[model samples]
Target: MHNLTSDLALALEVADAADAVSLAGFNARSFTVERKADKSEVTEIDRATETA
Candidate 1:
């Protein structure tokens, strides 16, 4: 019983939540960046966004 409209709305809500956490970190300049073993750079905001 999947509904297209509702699914899209849910997706948008998730995006908004992630954005909020991301922007908060950016605005406060409190995020940390780390290099993974793969040599890719990621930030605390990145991890928090995924957790959101």
Candidate 2:
């Protein structure tokens, strides 16, 4: 039970970090863009969000 609690806390921390990265990118006006293999739009924000 203690281990599960610790793991959940860690996951929440990671989520918060990711949210920060995503929000910053969302607010930024400029970022790179490219097409993925599936022909979908991709951008620098996308990469940063994934990394986070």
lDDT (CA) per prediction? 0.94, 0.85
Backbone-clash count (model 1): 0
Q: For residues 1-52, what per-residue lDDT tens digits would candidate 2 score against the true structure? A: 2689889999999889889987888788677789999999998887887788
lDDT tens readout by residue for model 1, 3-38: 999999999999999999999999999777899899
Q: What stretches of model 1 exceed 4 Å from their correct place?
A: none
Cα RMSD, each candidate: 1.4, 2.0
Q: What's the CA error at residue 10 for candidate 1, in Å?
A: 0.8
Number of the predicted model whose lDDT against the real structure is largest: 1
What is residue 36's positional error in candidate 2, in angstroms?
A: 1.0
TM-score per candidate: 0.87, 0.71
Clashes of 2: 0
